[model samples]
Target: MATHFEHLHAVSASQAYKATFASHEHTPSSSIKVQCPIEVSFSDDTQTQLAYFLRLLKQASQQSRWVTFIGHEALVDKNLLQSAGIDLNKVLVVCNKKGHSVQELMIQALQSGNSSAVIVTGDILDFTSGAIRDAAILSESFAFVINRQAKQQMTIH
Candidate 1:
């Protein structure tokens, strides 16, 4: 099971890179920015989804760059992440409660050139597709947005 999960992670990482690079050919005069948006569908198995996300983060960090997560404080589990072999020191969590708009924080993180990938969840109305593309072009990192409300079903039956 673990091997299968690892294989899936590897495949996902490869696909992300391919999609990111395939979209842009000519090298920008400034820096390399890869736009990779990973969407997490809402499900009863939040832990499973979280584990998969952590795996993605670990893969991104393998490039020796930091991973910045901007979202609600309850969305990330430090203990679970540490258990997954991710270095807490390399992870930066910016809570949405800090009074800054989540979108603003995301933009700052992407443009700061300090993170390899920025994972954003919750309240992403400010992150328009054009804005994300522009940010990716201006920074040296990848951006992933988690759709926490995706696949929501009203009927319990």
Candidate 2:
């Protein structure tokens, strides 16, 4: 798939870019990091999910980069992921309680190219497709956890 940033830039209005880019206040050292959020279902013994995370984590660790995780429940799963071979420091946890909006987190991740991957919970499902698309435009890969409960939110209508 095309990088998130590419997709976003393709559709984002110059005004929107000016607003976001202006707020960023780029510095001489400022850099852009790309992230692509992938949504994965969490089921019994999520070893496969954990393994996927671990593989990415290890690769990023090798490059001295880290993966930032969003959500409280996600953090719990990440703990289990450690057993699958994740480096603790290479996995930074940021719960929603930290009072960061998804957009804020994405921007922070983009600025910190040191993070190779970013994982967020289904809470992000509430964002407008435009926002998610924009995030994809800015990221290399993005991971989203779509819990079984989330599917129940759908109506038969």
Candidate 3:
């Protein structure tokens, strides 16, 4: 009887573990969207920053939608993207040639449901991250604001 009870407990524990982890797993077709508008930063002095960016971009491209880039065309080279295993056809680099502002473009892309992830790089501040978070939730997508900060230094305004 004790052995039977132990077996049932083991099964229940394993089931709980699976349930806990399944929600955190990323899938292209998953309805449970992840929290978005995640802010990340990298300094020019760091050697591993580009690698981290590539890894994150690769993961974001796993969805059916496009992985869009804004204001970072030089970094999104064909060779680099290919090395990251991201589909070249699914990648987009938009220039700010239009009258619309970069923030405006970011919000639109996040809410359009056409992009799996929208990545921007620059010294973009002064806008509200909450707005991006809301748009991301509405479209069930990811928004990455990659702030290229000062190189291993800080300044006070």
Candidate 2 stretches with Cα past 4 Å from truth are: 1-35, 45-47, 77-79, 96-99, 127-142, 146-157
Cα displacement (Å) at residue 52, model 3: 3.4
- Please report how far candidate 2 places residue 150 from its true position, in Å: 7.0
Name the runs in model 1 displaced over 4 angstroms: 1-36, 45-51, 96-99, 123-126, 150-157
The candidate 1 region of ten consecutive residues with least summed lDDT is 1-10
lDDT, candidate 1, 56-113, per-residue tens: 5665566566788886542456786778777778887777667886767877788777
Evaluated with lDDT, which candidate comes out highest? 3
Scored by TM-score, the top model is 3
How far residue 84's Cα lies from its native spot in candidate 1, in Å, is 2.6
| TM, every model | 0.59, 0.52, 0.64
Candidate closer to the true structure by TM-score (higher is better), 1 or 2: 1
Candidate 3: stretches off by over 4 Å: 1-34, 44-49, 72-75, 149-157
Pairing residues by index, what is the TM-score of model 2?
Answer: 0.52
Question: Which of 1 and 2 is ahead in lDDT?
Answer: 1
Q: lDDT per residue, candidate 3, 6-102, as tens digits?
A: 1221122122223323455533234413443434444444334456556556666777888888776324567978988888788888778788777
